[model samples]
Target: MPSQYRPQLLGWIDDLDKGTNYLSGADDRLLYANDNYCAFLRKTSSDQIFYLCISFICIIGSLFLIPSLIYSLPSCNNKAIYFLLLAGLVCSILILYVMIPELYQNLFTRKGCPIIFNRKTNKVYINESY
Candidate 1:
């Protein structure tokens, strides 16, 4: 149904009725629909490759600090210094292992993202990059 109060020159979706959006196919944005739920793909960033390159550059720049971190490695005979260095190493490894993989997840988000809407709960669920 056409909106009775649509704005002039503005493409605002004033029509709350859902009877017109029936298109659904692989090439269409509408992915699925049920009695109380539906999903549609959203447009992603236009510069994904640019951001991916920047992400790689940032990762490489962060790695330059690794050499400096190991520069103060203690001699094998100093127990206190050795234990401190060991602890630092363990902490660094744990941090990197837990966080670095999260950076790769958004590299391809430019393709598309599915946003789900649930009428039963009147809520929306968005997919996180991580």
Candidate 2:
């Protein structure tokens, strides 16, 4: 039979004696109480900042371009404005979708299968049974 494997949480240390996992940092914070590796694969502060910045730019561009497009509707023959308008609306919608906390959590947090430690075997396994 083929061996089964589970994904081990990276950058963490487990203590069977203490019955707790330690997360890396200056203070070495304790892992949160969860069977699943909640501490793994989190977005960094820099990533959050970048996402916010890009989202802001997209939103601002949409706000400006949309109004301009609406105001210029009398010139329906100008396909360029309509194209710009469509682009702006699409960008804004995409930004909003990305910013949605529920959607982000569902997509990034819940959907991933990560590696975790098998304490009994003293070996690591990739959690493919997600």
Per-candidate Cα RMSD to the true structure, in Å, reads: 10.1, 10.6
lDDT of 1 by residue, 47-85 (tens): 445655665665565466455457767445688877777
lDDT per prediction?
Answer: 0.54, 0.47
Candidate 1, lDDT over the whole model: 0.54
* C-alpha TM-score for every candidate: 0.40, 0.40
Instruction: Name the best candidate (by lDDT).
Output: 1
**How displaced is residue 30 in candidate 1, in Å?**
17
Candidate 1 residue 119 Cα shift, in angstroms, is: 2.0
The runs of at least 3 residues in candidate 2 whose Cα sits more than 4 Å from the true structure, single-residue gaps closed, are 1-38, 78-130
Model 2 lDDT per residue over 11-109, tens place: 343432244533334122233324433323233344545665665665566566656756665666768877876676566666556555433433344
